[model samples]
Target: MATAAVDRVEMSEAEWEARQELAACYRVFAMLGWSEMIYNHITLKIPGEDGAFLINPFGLHFSEVTASSLVKIDIDGNKLDDSPYPVNRAGFVQHALFHRHLPDAHCIMHTHTTAGMAVSSLEGGLRATNFYACNFAGQIAYHDFEGVTVRDEEGARLLEHLGNKRVMLLKNHGILVMGKTLPEAFIKHWSLQRACEIQIATMSMGTPIEVTPDVVAVHQRDLHMAQVPGGAGAADFAAMVRLVDKIDTGWRA
Candidate 1:
């Protein structure tokens, strides 16, 4: 497979940094077993560029992705860089639609992990049965599955269902999370995945004890407070990046 030759001269410091962070996100997803072969996508908008973002090459495994190998493309799925791998048009259509509609969503992540898909298939979506799940109370939106997200018109419905929500559950499909920053998105995805895992596990043991709405409200507020400018999620993401480096520093390249 041909690798994209990153021209440092053509990229600004911020863009390069974004590329590295986005690549690290892919590697971390692989590490956590959140990736679905080469199917799911995590996209980061290029700083200072309107409607420009970076996405993984269509055929590369998440673990094999590197900072320099990521493909740069516009919102319309047109490749802006010289790379042999073509962008996944379906993924581009879905992610680009969100990025175009939500200006604050600088980073977007989509996954089809076992737990996530299980929860998506549930009629109630994510439940507030655990602390991890409490954080997403009232912050999640649901979108009905309409086959694969390949058509252009699906974008409008997706955006409509995802109105102002950071996390979305695509019925019988998977989970998608958006964030103002890469770390924020990663942390949210981690929490959402864990919530789904716990939910599924508890369900197998008969009726799960649900957290009361009052307690859930308090916990959600506290979680929100902790995600302020220099919150725990940012710190946790920093530690995660360090762990990724320790596991395989090659992701930086």
Candidate 2:
């Protein structure tokens, strides 16, 4: 019991920063129409020797979240601190499963966007039809549907599909991303959404567009080269927060 108590306190200043970035990601997702009516979730692993994580409250929209409003929870989905808001059971199950298994995954972001959902229903899933789509080749995993995902048993199946991959295509559902930090996860989320939008637009045009394997490789190389280092998703988060601050700093209140 003492060991368990010690584990919860492992959160350091760095972990606190991760929390802030994770919170900002939620607000950005809400602003961009990626969130599904407070149904989707973005979670961050708190920095500590013991396992701890942060997730948004169940009732609040992503845009309505502040850093302090985020809830701290254990891998078992138990709340660690006092919070006025409750967590969505489905969201908790999705996030806790990943945090419990993936040591490298510090942040997990999931969404149910119109384009993403449309692509999930397709038989092809995310095809290697374009450079953006190709970026996730061999890196994306898929999980079959199992109802609303509120039960603990569903978590094992979800983790099995996720395996060691960083991105997941929740078939007939939505998109999921995991990374070492919020920036990595957010960038991946943006990429997946953009790819989905492109696929939908192209399919609507009724024209054949294709990319060769050689071109795909080149694009993959460029994508890696374009990747930035550091947990600076916080910088982008701070910028977004500043923008929101101008409109309504009620979040800070």
Candidate 3:
């Protein structure tokens, strides 16, 4: 197998901060045991309308990731960074669609958590049976299992499933969330994965579940409250960076 060579470049403050936040997201996922080796990806749109984004190289483990180690690539999945590591074609397939179709989504996150896979396997998929479940309500979208997402055909189907929504529970696969910033994507995923876990555990009780009325209205009101544009999510991201600093500050390397 051929390896893609990484070209080193100077990153501005914004770019570096993006990388660190993205890397922290990877580490947090790894720490939570959400990683499946190097198989999953969390991508952030490069700071321009150049149709380029940053993604992890194919070979490195999530724990080995660093801000400088991230590779820049175009929507076509071609490496703009000259990095020796190839970007995972499947990762690009889903990421490109979200970034290309959703103008507001600047960061695209995906994961293969245990509870996520469990939720994906169910018939209804992500049931709104609890408080956190109400967070998604009618907002969640589903993409049927289409094998691995390495082909162009899969991209269109995946895009159609994504529609105008911000989150997709890829049936029998994993979870993907998109946002305008790394913090938004990360926090959304955190909320989404928690919702899945909560639902599963609640269902285990084998008792009847009650759903809140006016779910769509609640979701609309909560969307702003969940990611207040420039508020708690941003602060949370900053705090996460500090947590990364406490242990694996090597991401800045």
User: Which candidate number has the best TM-score?
Assistant: 1
- Per residue, candidate 3 scores C-alpha lDDT tens digits across 137-219 of 88889989979887777777777777889899999988988887778777778888888999889888896376756764666
What's the TM-score of each model vs. the native? 0.95, 0.87, 0.89
Q: Listing every candidate in turn, what is its Cα RMSD in Å to the true structure after a full C-alpha superposition?
A: 1.7, 5.2, 3.1
Candidate 2: list runs displaced more than 4 Å. 1-15, 228-246, 249-253
Ten-residue stretch with the least lDDT total in model 1: 1-10
Worst 10 residues of 2 by lDDT: 1-10
Write down the RMSD of candidate 3 (Cα, Å): 3.1
Better of 1 and 3 by lDDT: 1
Instruction: Identify the leading candidate in terms of lDDT.
Output: 1
Candidate 1 lDDT, 164-205, residue by residue in tens: 788999999999999998888888899999999999999998
Model 2 agreement with the true structure over 84-149: per-residue lDDT tens digits: 678788888878888888888888988889988888888879877766788886788999987887
Candidate 3: C-alpha lDDT: 0.78
Total backbone collisions, model 1: 0
